[model samples]
Target chain A: MNLVGSFFGSSIGRKIIMALTGVILIGFVVGHLVGNLQIFQHPDHINGYAQFLHQLGPLLWVARIGLIAAALLHIWAATVLTLENKRARGGDYGFKHTIQATFASRAMRWTGVIVLAFLVYHLAHFTLGVVQTETFKETAPLNHYVMQNDYRVAGFTVVKAGTDVANVHSMVILGFQHKVVALFYIVAVGLLSLHLLHGFNSLFQSLGLRNAKWSWLLHKAALALCVVYFLGNLAIPGAVLAGKLRPQTAKVAATAQR
Target chain B: MTLRVWRQAGPKALGQFKDYAAKDLNSNMSFLEMLDVVNDELTLKGEVPIAFAHDCREGICGTCSLTINGKPHGPGKGIATCQTYMRSFHDGDIIVVEPFRAAAFPLIKDLVVDRTSFDKIMQAGGFITARAGSAPEANAAPVPKGVSDLAMDAAQCIGCGACVAACKNASAMLFVSAKVGHLGLLPQGQAERDRRVLAMVHTMDEEGFGNCTNQYECSAACPKTISHDFIARMNRDYLGATLRSAFQPEAASSDGGGA
Candidate 1:
C-alpha cells in the first residue's frame, strides 16, 4: 500500500525496485558477515564489538529502524510483484514448467519466503537476548559478550583493565554451546546464501545491465560470493556442534578438570 | 508442386487456405520466384493471381513479412521468404503462407497490414531530437562503445511484427522496448527522456498490446534476434518516468477544442 504497490504496479517499476533493494540487501549481508566473523578473532573481540554498537545511542536505533523498514519494503514489493505476475498468468492454467522457466526463476518466491523466516529466527537467536543466553548483549552483568558483528564503542577498550565486562561475551558462548541454537544459525546462513546467489545476479538483469561481455562473469562472481559467505557463517556453528572447538572458558575448564 | 495459402478477401470475410497446383515449375528458383511462376500461370488461365505483398527480393527491407508453414519468414534465421530458395522445400510439399494477423495489425487487401501504428510509436519517442535550428557538430557528443552497442541492439528491430504473432498473449512489449532503447541511450535524447518513455509506454498500453510475461519467445521468433534486454531497459525507463510524473504532475484540461 505504501511505496511498494506503486513501485511494483508496472513491470518496469517492479524490476527497478527488485534491483535496487536486492543490491542493498546484498551489501547488508556482506557487512553483517564481516562483523559476525569477528567472533573467530577472539572470544572477547565480539563482546568489544557489541559494546561499540551500544555506544551509538540514538543513531544506532535510527539505523536499526531504517534497516527494518528497508527489509519490509523489499519483501512486500517482491510479494506484490509475484502476485501480479501470477494473476497476469490467469491462475496458473496448465503445467508448463519445462516450457517457460529455469530452476532459479521457479524457485524465487519459495526461496524468498524461506529466507524471510530464517531471518526472524536468526535475529532472535543471536541479536536479541530472547530464546538464547542473555550474555550476547553489551551491558550484560558478566563480561561474557557475544558479538552480532556490529558494535559501537562506549570508551571501553581492552587496554583498560578495570572495564572488563563478562555479560556480552558469555551470552555468545552460551548461545553457540547449545547445539540446537547453533544448528539453526547454521541453517539460517545457508538459506541466506541461497537467497543471495539468485538475488545478486537477478538485480543486474532487472536493472537492465545484462551485457554479453560482463554478464557471465558477474553471474559467476555473485554465486561464488554467496557460497563463501554461507560457508563462513556455517563454519562457526558447525565447529561448536561437532566439538571441533569448545568455548574458550570451556577449554580452560576441561584442562583444569582433567 | 502445389501452394496452399490462406485468403480472406476482407476483414469480415471468412478465409481458408486453398491449394493451387503449379505446372512446369522450375526447381532452381527462389520460393517467391516460384510463386511468381504460379501467378503468371493463373493470370494466363483468367484467374486472379494470389494476392500477396513483397519488395526488394532481398531480405533487408523487412516488408516481405510472412508466416510460412507456421514459421516467420519461412524457417530461416536472419533470412526472409524473398531470399528463401526453393531447394529448401521438396517435391509435392504444400507450403502455407498467410498474412501477419493481430488486433493491432489489421490486414490490408491481402498480405499488407496497417503497420502505421509502428510509425506512430516511433514518431512518439524513437528519435533523438535536440533543439530545432541549433545543429550541433556530430562529434560534439562522445558515446561509449557499450551504449552504442546497446542502442544498435534495439535498432536491429525491423518492425517485422513477428514478436506479436509469436506471443500467445499478443504482447508488443519487445517491440515497444526496442523503440524506447533506441532513443534512450543517446545523449541527445536526454532532454525529452521522461516524456518520451511515458508517451511511448502509454501508447503501447492503449494499442492493446499485452504485457510482457518475460517468456523470451518474442526474442526467439525475431528475425533480427532482438534481445529481451530492451524490454528490461523499458522497465527501468518506465520506473523513472513514474517517479518523475509523481513529482511534476502534468496540467490537466489542456486540450482546447471546439464544440
Candidate 2:
C-alpha cells in the first residue's frame, strides 16, 4: 500500500481523520448558527448577510465544496470505525453491565444518524426552499453591491450584481411557525446536542490532544460548547413558535425590492 | 452462601449458571478455597467439578481471571479473583461467577479462555533485541526518578484480560497501551519504541480487539489498577509513530542504528 493509504488504514489514522473532519464540521455549524441568529435583528440584516455570501460567488462555492467533503469524510470514518467495533465485539455478553460509558456515548451512532437526517431536512427547508411551509414564498434576489452604499473591498468601491438572494430571515420565521416543523427542528437540535456532547470531547481524545491534567477541563469545555449550541439553535425555533418573531413586514420587503 | 457459577463443557457447548450451596464455609477462607470446598463435594458425588483458571494464588500471576457479580476480579478494586476472600461477602449472600468475556478471548471451558491472542500480540513486538549478559549496575543508564516511576506504573499490567472484560466494546486498548507504555518509557527499550508500538497495535487489531471509547472501565476493573492514562499515552505515541512512519519511513526503519 502507498504511504497515505496505509496511514489512513490504521485505527489511529482513521480516528485522526474523524477528528480533523469533525472539527471542521463543528466550525461550520457554529458559523451557520451565528449567521442564522441575525434573524432577530431585522429583515435587512439577514437578507444583506445572505447577499454578501452570494456576492462572494466562487469563494462561497469553494467553502460549500469543502464542507461537503468534510461531512463525507467524517461520516465515512465513523461508519468504518463503528463496523470495526461491532466486529471486535464478536457477540453480545451472556450478561452485561456498563460501568463508565454514558447514555450519549453509547447512543452515538444512532444520534449521528439523526443528525445526518436533520442536516438533509435543514438544507431542503432553508437552503433549497423545497420543504417550506404553504405560506412560504421566495424573496427576489438582492443586488447587494448596488444596495449597500458602504460596501467596499480592499478600500475600493466594488459594484456587482447579486442573484438568488432568498430572504432567509422570513423563511426561517415562517418555517418555525408551523408547529410540526418547529417540533421536528427542536427534536433534531436535541439529538444534535447529544451527539456534540460526546463527539466534542471524543474529537480531542482521538486527535491525542487530551492528557490527565487537561482532560477534566477539556470535558467541561466540550459540554459547555454543546449546551451553547443547543440553546443558541433552539432559541430561534422557540422564539418563532412563541410568536415572538414574525415574517418580514410589507414595508421591509418593499424597501428591499427597490 | 449460594454460589451461582457458570458451567460450560467446551468451547462450543451451551453455558448456563448453576447454583450451589456452600454449607459450613469459614469466613476466613479465601474465595477460591471456598470454591475448592464446593468442588471437593462435587468430586465425592462423581459430578464434573467446575473448571477455573488459577496459579500462584497470591495474585501476581494473571491466570485467575473471573468476572464476579458483573465486575472483573470480583467487586473490590485492584485484586485478582484468587485474592478475593469469603469475608468480603455476607453469610447468606448469593455470588455470581463467570469467565471474563471478549471476542479476542474465546471460551475454552467453564472459566478458562484462550488468552494466546495476548501472547501473539506480545510476540508481534513486545520485546527488545538486547544481548543477554550479566546484570548491569542499577544506575548504569541514569534514568530519572520520575520516568522510572511512570514506567513502573505502566509495567504493573499482568495481562489478566480484565480490561477487555470491563470494556463495553471489548477493547484491549488498555492492555496494549500498558505494554507499549511500559517499554516505550524505558531508555533501553527506546531502540524499538516506535516499531514496537506499531507492530503490537497492529497485532491487537488483527486479534479482533475493539477500539478504545475512553470510557475508563478498563482501568476501573483492573486487578493491577492500571491507569487509563496509559491508553492516552499510547494514543499519542501511536499518532507520532504513524505520522513518522508515513513521512519518514526510512528513518523509523533504522532502529537506533547500532541496535
Candidate 3:
C-alpha cells in the first residue's frame, strides 16, 4: 500500500477517517437544522431563503457532492470496523455482562442504518419533490406563491411583493399534516439523534482530542446537543400535528390539487 | 460452594461448564488457594485437576488470569484473580470460571490461553537503546517528575489479557498503546518513537484484535487501573509519526526504519 493508502488502511486510520467524515456530516446536520427552523418566521423569510439557495446552483451541487462523499466514507469505515469487531470477539462468552458501555454506544450501527434510510426518504420528500406530491410546493398548477413582506398577514399569491417563488413555507407545514409522515420523521430523527449521541462523543476519542480532562465536558455537551437537535426537529412536526402551525396559503393549493 | 468450571480437553475440544463441589472453603483463602484445595482433592482421586496459570500470585506479574463469574479477576476492581479472596463470595455461591476468550488468544486448556500475540506486538514496537557503560548520573537525562510518573503508569501494564477479555470488541489497543506510551514519554524512547508507534499499531491490527471504540472497558478491567488516556496518546503519536515519516523520509530511516 502507498503511504496514504497504508495510513487509512489500519484500524486506527479507518477510525480517523470515520471521525473526519462524521464531523463533516455533523456540521451539515446543524446547518440544515438552522435553515429548517426558519419555518417559524414569516412565509417570505423561508421562501426567500429557499429562493436564495436555488440561486446558488453549482455551488449547492458542490456542497451536495461533499456531503455525499462524507456519508459514503462514514458508512464504509463503520462497516469495516463493525465486521472486524465481530470477528475479533469470536465465540460468545457463556455469561455476558456489560459494565460501562452505554446503550447509545452499543446501538451505533443500528441507529446509523435507520438514519441513512431516513435521509433517503427525506430527500425524496423535499429535495426531489417526488413523495407526498400533493403537498410539494413546486408541484404543477399550484407551484407559484407571491412573496409578501408582511410577517403576520399570511403570504398569498396575490400579495404586495408579487414575486413568484416555490411556496417552501407551506410545503413543510402541509407535508407534516400527514400523521404517518410526521410520526416517521419523528422516529427517524430520534434514531439519528441516538446515533449522534454516541458518535459526537466518539469522534473526539477517535481523533485523540479527548482524554480524562475533557471527557466529562465532551460527553455532556454531546448529549445536550443531541437532545436539543432532536427536540428542535420534533417541534416542527409536532406543531403541525397539533394544529399550532398552519400553511399561510395552502388552502388555495390544496383545493386546486383536488 | 459449587464451582461451574469451563472444561475443555484441548484447543480443538468442545468446552462445557462442569460443576464441582468446593466444600469447607475458608473465606480468608484467596480464590487461587481455594482452587488449589479443589485440585488437591482431584489429584488424589486420579482425575485431571483444573488447568490454570499462575506465577508470582502477586498482581504485578499478570501471570494469573481467570474470568470469575463473567468479570475478569472476579468482581473486584484493580485486583487480579490471585488477589480475590473467598470472602467476596458467600457460602454455597455458584462461582463460574472460564478462560479469557479472543480470536488472537486461542484457548490452550480449560482456563489458559496463548497470549504471545502480546509478545508479537512488543517485538514490533522494539526496544530502546541504552549504553552499556557505568550507570549515567540520573541528572544527565533529566525527566520531569510528572512525565516519569505518567510513564510509570503506562509501564504498569503487566501484559495481562484481561483488557481483551473485558472489552466488548476484544480490542488490544489499550495494551499496545500502553507499551507505546511508556517508552515514548522519555528521552530514551524518542529516537524510535515514530517507528515504534507505527509498527506496534500495525502489528496490533495484524494480530486480529479489534479496534477501540473508546468504551473504556479495558481501563475498567485493568488490574492496575491504567487510564485509557494512553490509547489517545498513542493515537496522536501514530498520526504525527505517519505524517512526519511521509514528509521527512530521511528522518524515518535514520531513526531506525521506515514505518
Candidate achieving the largest TM-score: 3
A1-258, model 1: which lDDT tens digit per residue?
223544655555655766787787778888877876776766556656666566668988987887787788688777765554343222111111122334555566677788788788767766764654434443334443333333334543422333444444445555677777787777767766776777776777667676556867987898789789988888777766776655567643343233
TM-score (chain B) for model 3?
A: 0.95
Put down candidate 2 lDDT per residue, B1-259, tens digits, no spaces. 8989899999999989999998889888878888899999999999999999988998888988888888888877898888888888998888888888888999999988888999999999888888899878888888888999999988889998999988877888889989999999999889899889989988888898887776788998998989888887888888888767767736665778775
Which scores higher on lDDT, 1 or 2? 2
Top-down DockQ ranking:
3, 2, 1
lDDT of 1 by residue, B34-75 (tens): 888988988999977777777787766767766677665666
Candidate 1, Cα interface RMSD = 6.1
Give the runs in model 2 whose Cα sits over 4 Å from its true position. A133-164, A250-258, B249-259
Instruction: State the lDDT of candidate 2 residue by residue for A1-258, as single tens digits.
Output: 345764577776777788889899889998999988988885656766776777789999999999999999989988887788777766565557776778888888899999899999988877766775333335343222123333344665443334334556766776787799899999998898888888888887776667787888988898899899999999999998888898656544344434
Q: Is candidate 1 or candidate 3 better by lDDT?
A: 3
Number of the top-ranking candidate, with DockQ as the measure: 3
Best by the lDDT measure: 3
lDDT of each: 0.67, 0.81, 0.87
Query: What interface RMSD does every candidate have?
Result: 6.1, 1.8, 1.1
